[model samples]
Target: MSTVSTPGEPQARSKPPIEAVPVRHPGRWVGVGIVAIFAAMLVHSLLTNPNWGWSLISEWIFAPPIVKGVGVTLLLTFLSMIIGLALGVLLAIMRLSPNPVMSGSAWVFVWAFRGTPVYVQLFLWANVIALYTTLSLGIPFGPEFFTFETKTLIPAFVAALLGLGLNEAAYMAEIVRAGILSVDEGQEEAATAVGMSRLQTLRHIVLPQAMRVIVPPTGNETISMLKTTSLVIAIPLTTELFFQASAVGNRLFQPFPMAILASIWYLALTSILMVGQFYIERYYAKGAMRELPPTPIQKWRRRLGRGGSND
Candidate 1:
């Protein structure tokens, strides 16, 4: 008996299998180059500017008004962020409102605030010598109108606060809207089906879930707002941190070191904010833990289960 394969039988090839050649991302090389350039520039600049020496550093760092200014900066950053966050939440809800008037009003507010330059907005607000400027309180038509002069009613600091806080609110609103929308619609539906009111559902379920999305960017915004508050110097408020620093620098003619010192404070504040963001993100992600992609063992176990069921 001859051992022969049929004519239609398939033949197997014995060639070695090829593996993928690893590719390094261009971004890594770009990042490395940037670090190298940054290091070189830093070294060169530091070496050339030996006068930012210990004494000058200590003096500027310990200056009474500058020290006080740091406190003011913190106060302003905290107050403005709180104001912005509250406004952001309200604006986001308004933007998502079913009523055309509310939605349109929110849209116009965001568009005007975000579309214009923030610095210009600050300056315009500072110059609020508008005719018939009343010390309006409450809603547009909620009825209590105690009028006062614009200049008397709106101080430079108040104007600056309103400008930056309101402007920040616009950007923050979009961020909040995106964050809330990213949450599963089912969550809201579940709350509704459970007999939760819209406000209650939003306050509890939607907000908790949405927080995971918002916290990170909100932290970043807080950090950015710290630096941005420097723009308040245009309003000529000397109590804020940068203003005091600039005053010292102007008098001493050491603007370079003074500016660098101010930059250092900004860096410090932002670094703290970054750490805060990390913790907040971790906290918000508690319910979102998912097992990572399957390993070989997992793959085989799943396959076996499927195959056994097929039997």
Candidate 2:
């Protein structure tokens, strides 16, 4: 059918529809199948392995000594992280200071601590009484202040705490400094324009913004510190989980079971930490994001809803 338009009238034109395209991913199904098969095999081996000594593991799983060791390990991790965090904040502030001396001192501390192996440091701390028999308070090279024996002051637990906490402070300082740097320079300038001192600006504006960057790595460090607490054995801290479990194994001549027990506890603790980290990360992401990411539980529920709809 044909229609002629008048000279003053405009003609309406029809547009062509777009063609649809289907994407192909043939290897995706193959990769999924391979992963599924590997998972099945791993589960099968774990279930059927006879050398694991499941009976001994079950017996020692809730033993009083093991429970006590677990508690000590947790306590060390908590205390060390707290010390590290506080000391790290001071070091980070120092690193960012305008004074060259402050920055240099902070850098030297980080260099020394991070340069040496933590195990070696632990051993040295454990035997520090050899280098200095006594520790004292008051003026140095003057009238001696009240003195205390080094051995008396620094027992196995104290030595362990000192080694772990001091070493961790070095690493935490870098993490904190990076977090601080992630904040905008413009923000600092703006704060100064309003007559806020550097400390005040950091406390009120910068650190709060930096927390979003800080929290994730700090959570990772916390979990790592949990595992690193096992190294407290270098100080001969026999009350820690690794040492206690190994001691029990040596006594019973059943190393595998005791090792398994320790591993199970470590896994359980790390799993809890992972869940806590997830929630903490989500909380800190609030201001930076328009919408929050779905959690594992939410994703599962969404998948279930979709499946039900299909049915």
Tens-digit per-residue lDDT, 186-245, candidate 1: 999999999999999999999998998898899989988888888887775679888888
| Per-residue alpha-carbon lDDT of candidate 2 for residues 1-311, written as tens digits (9 for 90 to 100) | 44545566556643445556656777988998999999999889878987787888898988999999999999999899998999998999999999999999999999999999988989999999999999998787888768999999999999999999999999999989998999999999999999999889999989988888999999999999999999977888889898889899999999988998999999999999999999988988877999998999998899898886532
lDDT of each: 0.83, 0.91
Q: Which numbered prediction scores highest in TM-score against the true structure?
A: 2
Q: Which candidate is the best by lDDT?
A: 2
Model 2 — TM-score against the truth?
Answer: 0.88
The alpha-carbon lDDT assigned to residue 302 of candidate 1 equals: 95
